[model samples]
Target: MTARATADSEERAPWLPMVGLFLAQMLMSFNVAALPVSIGGMVEDFGVPPTAVSTAIVTYGLMVAALVMVGAKIGQRVGWLLVFRVVVAAFAGSALMMVLSPSVAWVIAAQAVAGASAAIIVPALVALIAANYRGTQQATAVGSLGSARALSGVSAFLIGGTLGTFVGWPPVFVIVLVLAVAVFLFSFRLRSAAGNKSVDIDVLAALLIGAAIVALTLGFNNLNGWGLLQATREAPFDVLGLSPAPLLVLVGIILGQGFLVWTRYRTGAGKVPLVSLSVLGSSRERAAVYAMFIVVALEAALNFTVPLYIQIVQGRTPFDTSLAMLPFNLTVFITATLVVRSYERFSPRVIGVFSFMLTTLALLWLSFVVTNNWETVPTILGLIVFGIGQGALVTLVFNVLVTAAPKELAGDVGSVRGTTQNLASAVGTAVAGAMLVGILSLNVGQAVINDVDIPDRLIAQVDLDQVNFVSNDQLREVLTRTDASEAEVDAAVRINTDARLRALKLGLLILAGVSALAILPASRLPGYRPGEIPETLVARDGPTGPDRDRSTDGTVLEK
Candidate 1:
């Protein structure tokens, strides 16, 4: 009798609703991709160091990691359509705040709101797909989420870079506002799902998991600014003569264990838990997670390092940053979308190993070939190779994990993916920041000591230990206060430039080693053939046979 409700039922599996979902995914990822490119502009506008912008990046990721599970439960309780639309509106508000943010602090606050919106949006996207589609269509929709993310990265670098270079950094978020409104309007095409009023929110488990993420994020994030093990001058407090960073990390680990123990207890009592432990209960699943963590972390590190080098060290525009990074971003988008087509031909384990090797080789080659110029042919080729590897791994591991689980648990899989990805991103960016600054300090001190032209007094005038990424113009401004001759300023500039390049090269080598070591986990991935997602409840170890053989193995169909 109702026309609107009938139309909603008739438009089942329409492209419009999927467009809304894809744009939502893009809205979240594009903001993140653009942030790094705008680092130079933000630093110039706010008159802050690069670490300030880095902290904002970490803040956004930490918020998502801390709240995504809870966001999922809230979505189920309040109804997906209602929750999704509300967050989209809130996301628009956050974008407006970002556009008007007068200081870096406001920028951080805006991203905090955006991250909170995304916590719900990430899980909601998967839940919507499950509710709307079935069979091969459902699988394709799920796979598209990965491509949407990669494509948004490409769009962000191009669009955000152009705006940041010619216009201003504030305008980068204008696209987010536009997309949020568009998604909100098209969201009506999605089928409606009723809220489950009986679902209980697990508060204790929430606190434990949230605490664990905060402590871990803070501990890793402060390693460079605060002392890794001992008290540094920048540290806020120490624990019994030891730095609080390690103590916080220890606390985080303890809380994480506590959360797991509590989950087991809750499961025994037949009470709903924050996250289903069974998602990662098997070794195959755990290996998939480990592999996911490595690729995501490497991605975060490179994303941060490349922009910092281009903008601050080389004094390039964000548009130039876009052009320089375009080869990799475009390659990743293409590879992620096409990688799924190869699953039926090759096993995931085989593809994973090959991809990681490509990434490792690319990083090593880049470390050697990267000079002051990013437009060089060797650098472009290395980026393209790395992109292909990185993009393939991202899609493959995600497919392996999602397919291995039952279809009903897709929401849990999405939540796990979001948490692992954002947490790894936070850790990756923080670790890279710490590693680069730590290396830069070491090199600068050595260079200062070895070269008699730069005076010790000049080093004392500014805090050398608190070094952050700065442009040559910023460095020149700082030198204006010091009583230095023209030759002294030139010597300091050359020394800083050389030290930065050396530190970058060494840092890449370390990351290359990290990527190479990731092969151990990749080798542990399940030996399932392509296009085979086990539908039945697998053995505690994992399924041994292909999809068709899974039925006769006495495997119970999961509820």
Candidate 2:
């Protein structure tokens, strides 16, 4: 059958296409949540410190943020359908490499490639929805995608913990590979839509963005280890001989960013710049973008810190921690889906403002109520409320951002949205991680100062440099074997508890402040209801005649 005929005659249910897209999106989303669950196993398998193992997560976020625009440009140059197929294949290959990775470095490399490939698929999927659906159909498609992402996160925690326990960390990659293959096969059934004309992509622009992102990420990652006030540090400021350079890296980031801005203006009259600062010239759109950045950053920080608090402070296993947080995701999925369907009945601005308020309140409550008391109920309840608020907030922002852009510029706007979210996640994780490390270090130092009865020689033999690498279990074992008095063990426990509680309080406070800032932009969101039909559509004036095309049944195409 001719392509036009097939497009018109295709009788598949609307939900079928949405389901396939959701599965594809879920595979990518699952990896984000799964990596945290397998962090311990990864450290053991690769024989690396926990901090080193975490580089994989940090690099994945950086790569995704850095390459999203490049990926979108490639899709527009090629066909979105073609790019989608290639990306799915690349994702599978990357996952396979990760499964067989022999070292931490190889694992990180594989993740980076997979992250970039995943970046390509996300914007393409959104573009596909815009091409294939209209009106309420398009809204439903977008909502399903958002809902699937939330549900995938919840599944990742549960599935990763279970699989990692029995089958080991490598099996997590294996599962991802299998899912990628399924997505690829399903995508083959997609009918090709109208192709996007090729656009010039500046290679130099891509490189500058990637370099800036890496430098910023590394700098933030090192902030705690290298004191912000310390200006003259070594090649990498040695924190217990584990080098983390904050200042120099941040300087490089600033320089690179400056270069990018200069280049953008220099090449302005030529082909369109990779990112047009003009988009931000719109006050409403700019506000929405900034709000998204803050909301994602806050969510990322809270997600990272809360799980650590549960496992380290409360002494829960990974499985128990995952289970404890399940309700948060459940609430998010349900509330977000409901909000998407009924959005037209309420104003987007009102919904967004209300959601941000709830999120801020939840964070503040968490900061006050989370102590060493192991109070799981209050924490869980707070998280559930936070999750619902976050889900509504994100969905509302995404819909507003995508719909507000000119139809011709949809691809560009989607690229910006994806990249901004990735960068926000990286920044949030790094900041929260640095704070946690700092809290741990201070507690360790205090414990050492309080120790009595230790001989001067024995005290000298104790290596402060090794303390950062020591796990809680290892610390307990060390104290047990040292012939220390019960008072010493008690002191160690107290120090650990105090450090964890302090970290949680500080992290939640940061989240609350950031979430509150979201209101400023959220209040400016277009006051339209959700699922409102656009007055115009892309390609609305394109040619239509018998010579142009006709369906097999000789009816004008509807899709």
Candidate 3:
């Protein structure tokens, strides 16, 4: 079909399936966001530490990151529609498990199941969108995906907090079940495509990749608990008198490189690689992935940090946490949806760099503004500004990625997107937790040593080295047990407050530097303009000669 023909066909296209696809995306993101909100409730119900709940989040991310490439291959080998429907049913089952979970272990298992389902659904969304839409409609559909993610996060904080507060955390997952059913019921409206039987799934590469990601997540997740470089009491084991956390990270990097080498070997031998290397075949696509990882990672960091501060440190309700986060999350949703409107007026280079600059500035602003009290105006304004930058970058990078690749490889694109995003989320949350706690320990020790009010002899009595985020109330209770005077306990509380706040400010400043460095990658983003759809489509559908009718007329309708 020509431009006019494709536009006409798009107008006649059924949009009901897009709703199902959008909901599928939302289901995954909402569940991820819901985990943090439910941390307080889960800690109370299961009598486990917040770290235990944090494990469930990491486990889910690990599963998705490890299996998503294999999942993408599975979708191509099996028909996308068939695999999609099956996984949707599995996701619903996972939700049922969430509702009936008896322990933190059960919750982790349930999330792992959901992550496996999402691994497939993530890739299927891109493939399905490719199968169903073309021309400008396709661009809009892709852009809407970013908005769907932002919208899901917003809904999770609002709805999850409400349900976790009043009803319970289990009831919060009921929302996921509802969305799953809605997606499953409407999935029949999606266009079906034939499976490519010729493609082979590379199991060896899968194992290597899975192991690499598992190592990476475990390493980062335990950086605080296990120790960053030296052995702490919590270290499961040691590596040459050094901490295993950093060792695992090193091993993960080596294994990751091995996977790349293996893939090249397979490709050189004329075998079908698990994922297409061409997805990041260009410098531009590689840069897009790099930038996407940083933005998403920062987003994950903020989402985890803010909630942990409010609900855990401040001992506030989830509702209060939600109220504090609403401005930022709501801004992300609105900006993600609206960012595409600027595509025609501004190049992605301009938008990408500007967005990174905005995020960098916002984080700097937030570093200065954040106090123990997050409800203040300056902090909220900083959050809103950061959200706008975050929202725009996510959508913009995604669009650049999708448009740069051929439509036939949409599943590969989706798999790459899923892996990068889930892995980033895992790394981001882990690093944020680790960095803050690490800094707090250092600051606390220094405060204890330097302040005459907090004598060295008194600090020596306490295990100040194994520091973690504790409520002021909890700290007071601990200090009361110690043979300390009233003035001493008060000083300890003051020291804890000042040190924790100082650590957070330092973390934000470091993150601001990272955001600033990401401007380099953003500079390399694809420069395809919105109206360049004709050229992009031509690249996909091929020249308008012999294969014109067969390729263009029913490109999406092929079975």
lDDT of 1 by residue, 126-209 (tens): 778767864444545666777889899889989887887789888889998998999999898897578788877899998998
Tens digits of per-residue lDDT, candidate 3, 1-559, equal 3233424444656777899998998999999889888888889999999888878888788889999999999999988999999999999999999889999999999999998999999999989988888656666777788889888988888898888877888888999999999999989999868888888999999999899999998998888788888978889889788999999999999989999999989988999998888767666678889999999999989988997899779998878888888899889989988887787667787899999999999999989989999989999999999999999999888776676566668898899999898878878988999899989989998888888887666777789777888889999999877788889999999999999899999999999999999999999765545543334344344311222211122231111
Error of 3 at 223 (Å): 0.6
Better of 1 and 2 by lDDT: 1
| Deviation of model 1 at 544, angstroms | 13
Q: What is the lDDT, from 0 to 100, of the residue 45 in candidate 2?
A: 86
TM-score leader: 3
Candidate ranking (lDDT, best to worst): 3, 1, 2
* Each model's lDDT: 0.80, 0.70, 0.84
Report clash pairs, candidate 2: 343-530
What local lDDT score does residue 454 receive in model 3, on the 0 to 100 scale? 78
> Which wins on TM-score, candidate 1 or candidate 2?
1
Candidate 1 Cα outliers beyond 4 Å, as residue runs: 1-16, 36-58, 100-109, 452-464, 467-494, 530-559
Q: How well does candidate 2 match the true structure in TM-score terms?
A: 0.83
Alpha carbon deviation, residue 331, candidate 2 (Å): 1.7
Give model 3's TM-score versus the native structure.
0.92
In candidate 3, position 24 carries an lDDT of 91
| Clashing residue pairs, backbone N/CA/C < 3 A, model 3 | none
Q: Could you tell me which 10 consecutive residues in candidate 2 have the lowest summed lDDT?
A: 546-555
Using lDDT as the yardstick, the better of models 1 and 3 is 3
